[model samples]
Structure formats: structure tokens, C-alpha cells
Target chain A: MRVSELVQRSGASLATIKYYLREGLLMPGEATSATQASYGEEHLRRLALIRALTDVVGLSVQKAAEVIQLIEGPGDDLFLTLGAAIGALPPYVESSNEQAQDYPLARTALERLGQVYDPDYPAVGQLDRALTAASAAGFPVDDDRLELYGAHVRAIAEYDIDHVPEGPAQGAIEYAVLGTALYEPVIAALRRLSHQDLAMRRFVPDSATDPAGS
Target chain B: MRVSELVQRSGASLATIKYYLREGLLMPGEATSATQASYGEEHLRRLALIRALTDVVGLSVQKAAEVIQLIEGPGDDLFLTLGAAIGALPPYVESSNEQAQDYPLARTALERLGQVYDPDYPAVGQLDRALTAASAAGFPVDDDRLELYGAHVRAIAEYDIDHVPEGPAQGAIEYAVLGTALYEPVIAALRRLSHQDLAMRRFVPDSATDPAGS
Candidate 1:
């Protein structure tokens, strides 16, 4: 595919694609002739991931480039690539302070889940940021609720791990990363709807009486 | 309590508290004297919610104000208030086209979950955005995976709905909204950590054999 096809297919503006190329966030396509280059499926995949990182995951270009770098270089090394991905988590999800107060709740939460309480862990840092922020907002997550939620998510995560694409490392990595990035909104939406469904059941009695609703 | 006390208690700065007041997000404090007005517990709670909205949930100040509007005015009406909060969801979390093409996966996913497939539903819109983005990135969510995730999230949602604080409608609204906003990061972190734990179990040989890890 040509650069134009890349632009059209990826739904990204030409200038945006050009910007990614200039920034080295994207690998350049094969040069066919003067001012013309051909992109392959790999380029398209790369472009899609880039757009998701910036547009969906909301990582800065610098951070997205780092992630792209790690993804391209590290094949089948999930932890090593994801370690860099964790670096992008807090800033990508929310603009939190790096030097924020220590997250005692996050550490304890991890430890209780039978995992080592590693502060350097990305999710741990993210958990700390979230717990600290929630506490700041005067809506602290209690230990019991955290434990229950932990158990529930552990089930979900096991399913996710079980289903990660096998064979190709790149495919598996893409699935894990994209699934992590994209499915979050899906999970959040499903969770919200589940809440809404229950709320309707509990509060909206009329829904139960309605023949179609049940 | 005085403004200083509100700041001390709420962890928001004076300028921020003033901004919320100026924006009418917080109810005005009683006029204690010429030089000072006294705030109360309600103000502290209101401020806490506001900070969570802007800082943690990453809503714009305008969106945050609108949420505070919905929360304060529409007590006991979870659907009505959250309907407005739904208005804030896409822009708050991920920037996606509200006018983007139709979302079949989202609708089907909802219908499969025994919920009304209302396009107007906020989570539907969010789910649509996520699915569409995923598909465009060449990782379209299949029906089986969507249903599997739907089933998984249903369990978590029930627990969350069950845990909605009893008593004041305002308090209930606060919990639902804050829990929706705050616990997302927690859930994401937990899901990620669970995947890590599993990945360690399957791939890391030393962890199983190591006495401390088990």
C-alpha cells in the first residue's frame, strides 16, 4: 500500500502520518520512487497502534515513541516491553505527580493479592496514584472493597491471560497491549451498564413490571 | 468552618476553592462576617468531588462544574444525574467521535447482556467508541470475546451496585459517581497485576520453585 492508502486506511490525516514519520514514532515505508513510498501491513499495524496510543491511550508523542521503540525491539519479552508500557501508564491515564506521597494502600493491596509489594511495578504505581487521588477526594477505597474487587479482577485477568494469542510474539504483544488499552473502556462501560442494570432493578420497579423489560 | 479549615480538610488550595465558588459548583458559604464567610461539611464534600472530577477523572473545569451541577441538584435520581454525567464520559476518558459511525458490537454486546440497546446510553456510546477504535486498529472485538467480557463485567458490576452506600441520596450519588470515576484506575491496575501474576506463574520458572514467591 502507498502512503495515501496508509492515510485513508488508518483514518489519520496525511500530515499526522508525516508527523509520526518525522518523529520516528513510525518506521518509514519502502521507498518506491521519488516522493513515493510503499507501506506494508506492518506499517498499517504500527500506525494503528500509534494512533491508539496518542488518540485513545492519550500518551504524549515522546511517550508513545518510547512505547513504539520498546514494542518493535522486544519480541516475546512481555515483561520487558510492558515494563516500559508501565512507565507510560500514570501519565497516560491521568497526569499524576511522580513524587507523590508513598502509596501504602497500593503496596498492601498488592501484597494481599499474593504478589510481591514492588513499588517499581507499573500497575502498583498506577494503583498508588489512584488510591492516593481517591483518598484526596475523600473517597478512600477500603481494604475489604479492594480485596473483593481484586478477587473479581483476578478472574477476569486469568481469562485474559489464557486467551492471549499464542505462537507469534508480536501478535501476542499487540493483543495484550491493545486489549489492555482498548478493553479498558469496554470493561468500564460494561461495569457501568451492569451498575445501571442493577440500579434499574433496585430503584426502577416499573422496569420489572414491564413485560418487555424482563 | 473557615476557608482555611476547608482547605486544610479538603486538600484543595484556596484559589481552587474560590474558583469552584465563583463557578457555582459549590454552594456559597454562610456570611459569618464582613471579612469572612464560613463553610460547612457539605462544602468540603463538594470540593472533594470536584477535585476528583478534574484532577483524577480528568474532566475539564467546565465538565466538572456541570457534573457538580447534576450531583447537587438531582438527589436520589441516579439515572437522571448520571445521564448528565454520561454526557461527560467520552471527553473525560478518551477523545473519540460522538458522531463516529454506528457501533454494532456495542449494541449487540448490550442486548446480549439483557440490557436495552439504547444508543443514547452513555456507556453504549463509550463501548461503541472503544470497539470502533479497536476494529480500526485491526483488532476488532469478536462476539464471543464481547460476550465473555460482558459476562465477566456483570459479576463485578453486581458487587459494585451492591456496595452503593445506603442512606442519603446525595451520598449515594457521590459514591456511584466517584466510584465510577475512581475505581476505574483501580480495576485497570488490578487487571494488569493479575495478568502479571499469571504471566509470572506460566512463564517465569524460578517464581514457582522459589519459596518466598509461593
Candidate 2:
């Protein structure tokens, strides 16, 4: 369909679609005329993902662009790869690159995570790609923190797979939808709520506390 | 302890402490003499919580103040309270003027959550408080979505209780820490990794038919 039709179907404005195309976030469809191009399902899906990340999760356009590229790239072991990307784990760093070697603490953390998870060979490569994407986007996680995050990821993913209904395959798809559709708002809301609750609990007099319990 | 001592123990700079005081986020310690007010352990803890919310999570002083108020107030079924606070479910609307007929939507959602969980009264209250805390901090969740989140939270909490090393009490604490401390970064990493991995598997030319299966 034409850009106007794509906008109506996708629920995105024509200007926004143009902006996305310019930013290389949306690949244009086959050209029907000098002024018109046809879009299809792929564009719709991409638009939805973009909305989730940018509008819902609040990632910068540049960062979102990098994420889109990674998603559309070539790799195996997507689950593990996704884990790495979300955590900003580096894929491969050469030994002699001084800047890359700058944070020993972070690098060590990543290494330790690799040791603990035992996610097979493919898992390691995927983790590295995520790391690369994070670095390229300039998210401020150090290697050590990345690895710590990796361990946490392993735990949550394990918990999610083991616990969610209909086995890992179905759970995986639910997870993807949840992450894309619901994760951002849920997290943002929870964080705001917890912060307030903790702060209030700390300063207020312990009225409910029983002396006997203490 | 004087402000100087409080500063040393809390690791907060004098300027920051002053800011908190001005913002009404931190209450003044007991006054022992002119220019020599004394703070105690309670002050120290409150300061730490404030720093976590403001410095780490990046909430504004005004927003932080409102959250702190709710946390300091009466202890009730937190889940229910949170639901009320965030409008995820009907919050019982504590004030006298709030009319029994108002907020029908919120009331319904809260009732649904109460039925599904059958949590003891306190747990319901905590969940409500959590939701409220999140809402006041500007998480952008409406009452209806919060009910959906309540189900997710219930699922995760139940699953963790069943599987984790400790009993429900300890498990609850652990999940709280994990959710509060690690969920944000971890989820971000996972989303990135998942998207790239899936994209590569589905779209990358000449790659294996299923990268994950491979």
C-alpha cells in the first residue's frame, strides 16, 4: 500500500513514517511511481516495534536504530542472543584495543557470567553480539556489570521458562509479547511505586511495630 | 549525630542533604542546641532510601515527596493499597468525600484481583501500595492495565515461591530486590537479544532454517 494507506493501517502519522524511513528504521517498499511506494506486513510489524521501543520504552532514535539492525542481522541461538543484546554484553573484543580494555572490572564480570551460565557455545556468541550493540549505542554499563546482569538474566529466563505455561516455546512467544507490549510500562510503573513506598516507609514513625516483636 | 556525622555515615554531600531538607524529603533531626541539631539512625536510613530513589532511579524531588508520603502512612493490605494508589484497580478512595459511587472501573479491577489471588488481607494491601507507589511516580499505567499486571505479578510470585530456595517470606524479599534492583537493565538486555536473535533466524539470508534450533 501507499505511504498514506500504510499510515492509516499502522496508526502512525505520515510525517512519522517519513521520519522513520529517513532514519533507516523503516525500509521502503517497492516503488510504484516517482512519488509513491508500497508497504506491506513487514512495515506494519516494524512500525509496531518502533512504537513500543520509542513511544513506550523511551529509547532514543539512534539507539532504536541500532537495536533494529541487530534484530534484523544474522545470528543463531536467538534466545541467548536476545539475552546478550538486552543486557549490553559485548560479542568479541580484541586483547590489544586499549579503549576496549579500559574497564577491567566490567570485563571480568562478563567473563564470570560466561563461566556460571554454561549456555553452550551459541549462547556465548549471542551474548557478545548484545554487548556490541550496547557499546555502539553508548549505554554506560561496564563489562563487570554486564556480566552481573547476565547472571541475573540467566536466573530470570530460567525462572520464566520453567514457570510460564505451555512449555518454553509458547512461553518464549508470550515473553516476547510481554517484553514488547507490556514490559516497559509495567517496569516503569513498578519502579516509581517501589521508590515511593521505600522512601515513605523509611521516614515515617514505626507506628505498627510492636515492642514485643522488636 | 550532627549533620556532619550523618553526612559521613550516609555518604551524602552537605549540598545534597540541604537540598533534601529544603525539598521536605528529609525531616530535620532533633535539636540539641542552636546550630547543633542531632540526627539518628532513622534519619540515616531515610536518607539512604531517598538517595536510591532520586540518585539511582532519577525521580524529581516533587514526585519523590508524594511517594514518600504514601509509604509513611498507615500499613494496610499493601497490594490493595497500591492498586488504589495507581488506579489499576478501585483504591477504596480513602477520603470521606470520595463518594461510594465514584471510580467504578477501579473498584471492579481491584475486586477481580482480590478474587483471583485470595491473598490474605495484608498481601492485597501491599500490592495496592506497590501499584500506588508506582503510579505516583509517573509509570503511566491506567487502572485496567494494572489489573493485568497484578495477574502477572501473582504468577511470578507464586512460581518463585514454589521453586526458590526459601519459603514465601524470604522469596518475597528476594523477588522484591531482584525486581527493584535488576529488572530494568536485565529486561532491556533481554529484549535486545531476543529481537536480534529472532530477526537473524527469520530474515538473514543463507542462515540456518532455525538459528535457535541449530
Write candidate 1's Cα lDDT for B125-161 as tens digits.
Answer: 6776677667767778787777777777777778778
Residue-level lDDT tens digits of model 1 in A99-210: 5535567767777767643355567667776777787677788877787788878887877888888787986876777677777777887888777777777777666444
* Candidate 2: tens digits of C-alpha lDDT, residues B91-162: 222334434224333334445544332222222333443333333322334555555544444443333233
DockQ of 2: 0.05
Query: Which sections of candidate 1 miss by over 4 Å?
Result: A75-77, A91-101, A205-214, B1-11, B39-45, B75-77, B91-101, B205-214
DockQ of each: 0.49, 0.05
Candidate that scores best on lDDT: 1
Docking quality of model 1: it rates as: medium
Name the regions of candidate 2 deviating beyond 4 angstroms: A55-62, A74-84, A88-115, A118-214, B1-16, B30-38, B54-63, B74-80, B84-214
